[model samples]
Target: MNSEEQPILSIRNLNRQFGSGCRECGGGSGQLIKNYCLSCGTVYACRDLSFDVFPGEVLGIVGESGSGKSTLMKCLYFDQETTGGEGYISTYKDGNANLFAQSSQEKRYIRNHLMGKVYQNPILGLKMDFSSIGNIAEKLISAGERNAAGMEERGMELLTHVSIPVHRRKEAPRNFSGGMQQRVQIAKALSNNPPILLLDEVTTGLDLSVQASVLDLIKGLQRELGISIILVSHDLGVIRMLADRTMVMLDGKVIEKGLTDQILEDPQAAYTQQLVHSLL
Candidate 1:
């Protein structure tokens, strides 16, 4: 593909602000921001952020909590409305089209048809009360794949792909271990056959061994499905293992961005260097 045809997602000058009142709080101010809780005043979560995700490439975003990685991803995926700037997600065979500027109906079409998301907390993505396989099939049907047999077939395939036992397909996710729950979440995220997958701190609560396995599973899926992915994580090791490119964020801005090896081995920014060093 030509350069113009390469990128599946592009973001430019993206900004998001959260304020308690109508007045916007500038980025310089210190404030605590929560996902659902907007404080008494506004807080800037992202500022002039820009990046791209190429077709079939895995881009890793690394930063401490409150650095705006999650917020940026959320905005790109249209989970949250943007305060300013532009973002595009490729929907047609021709090239990328602006997503942020689209009408609500248009954005909804792209989100449901082309994008899938996995949250840091696995339960947020999977229904704890439903059987693991049931949740996966539900996503398939919701995506408009109406054939019940097809949904069941794909659901079982995904469960096996994640190494969940066939017998456990009928068991509720609440009874599974943390790692198992995450595996089921992955299955659900893949149910829609989305071209882009946004993963937020996917392995956060899993043990080291489980983390390694899950990372391996993601890599394998990427190779097999050829879907573009943006993964946000605090774990440098996860970034090093999964990302071809890495972007480091600090204080609601992108401080460094480059190939994963370049950023890890010879970081130029002080904050980037500090983050790399902290991993050692």
Candidate 2:
């Protein structure tokens, strides 16, 4: 790939504002507030956001609760619709076409074939009633892999990859510990070997040790598979462990972005400084 090549993913001026603009709220723009609209009771869960994730790089998005980080991830994976913006996935249109302009079927294909996600809550990522193997199979099935033997083999390989014993492949996630369940979720997400992965607060509810192990697993996967990843986390520790570059968000806007070392050692934004200080 050329050094000047476009980003694997690019988002331009993404907006996901709720409620119609009103005069009292400055038409829902121009520094009216962070999220809520005093005029029309609107919410801007995402607002005028733009960034890029380069191939084989981990782009960390860090923000506190209600900072619109999760919302941005959802929009990237098409879990939620964008109010306005242009998104491009290089694998789809050589990084020139807008992703939101694609048909529903096209979007689904991109999501299924090009992207993978591990939700913070295992429940969102795993089916409680289904066996661990079955959950992995579901994703394989979505991507049109129909051979039962192949699915089972891939599922087993993934389970082992995440450090889940193959013996428990037939058990449901609900039967496992929180960390094990999360491992299963990671297994399921990687079943298809998608090039891009989205991880949303993936270690939030786990214990410190568990969190370390999970983060290590992710780092290993990135190194081994060379997958481009968008990692959304409020925890600076998580960001520091995984991210090559970082984007700091405050009130639905990016306040600072640079290499992980730069953000941690020499933050520019006041909010980022406050955040880094709290970590000490």
Candidate 3:
């Protein structure tokens, strides 16, 4: 939480919109019903999002559905293009480059070598037909690991780290349970040993006991690897458990942000107050 330490990742004025905006809405002068423009029909999914993820820290982004938290994650991971913004990763180009404007080839390099992402849906992150270890190998290969023996060793190590049984390494993710599929996805994401991890609702929709286990696994991984993480979830409880700092988003804008303990105990924004109260 040192203010002076260099950030591993930095985003500035990030914005994403579904449709071309009219002058009224596009100019940031008109009011919208929720996040959609009534006149021009442009949906501003993410607006002016800016944040930093410090080394070895978890920065939680909490928001309701359609609050643009997931959109922000997508932009960061390059699953979706940003309409406008700039992003810098300390591990890339000495943090001098804007990631949003990178060429496709450069973006691929950054995605493969500098960052990892685990999607809420395992299908989005894992190839359902591929063996669990094969999924991990795919990531390893993308990161330029051409030696099959080396990849197998790395894949096995990652699967074991995520608690996936050795015997089941050859099974496809389609055969695994919800929680197990997520574990495999996590293993695959970590296969390249990326410095930054993006986790979008990793524990969502799991049974209570299963959710607890996945959260604990993530907590342990962060502590062991010392990797910076950006975790997006609507669950305040999840943020409380893992995040050192938390940001609250509403209607595609950041309403409040601060240390997790401070926000939970004395939330400043009215919307944040309701959210914190609900966690009781």
C-alpha lDDT of residue 185 in model 2: 87
Best by lDDT: 3
Cα lDDT tens digits, model 3, 1-280, are 4533989999999999998889778544477888999988999999898988898999999999999999999998899999998999887888899999999999999999999999999999999999999999998888888999988888889989999999999999999999999999888988888999999999999999999999999999999999889999999999999999999999999999999999999999999999988889
> What residue pairs are clashing in model 2?
none
TM-score of each: 0.89, 0.96, 0.98
lDDT score, candidate 3, position 195: 90
Candidate 2 structure quality by residue, lDDT tens digits, 21-105: 7777664564465778876887888878899888899999999999999988888888889889999888786767799888889
Off by over 4 Å in 2: 1-5
Which is the winner by lDDT between candidate 2 and candidate 3? 3
Q: What is the lDDT of residue 188 in candidate 1?
A: 89
lDDT of 1: 0.84
Please, what is the whole-model Cα lDDT of each candidate in the order they appear? 0.84, 0.89, 0.92
Residue-pair clashes per candidate: 4, 0, 0
Give the lowest summed-lDDT range of ten residues in model 3: 23-32
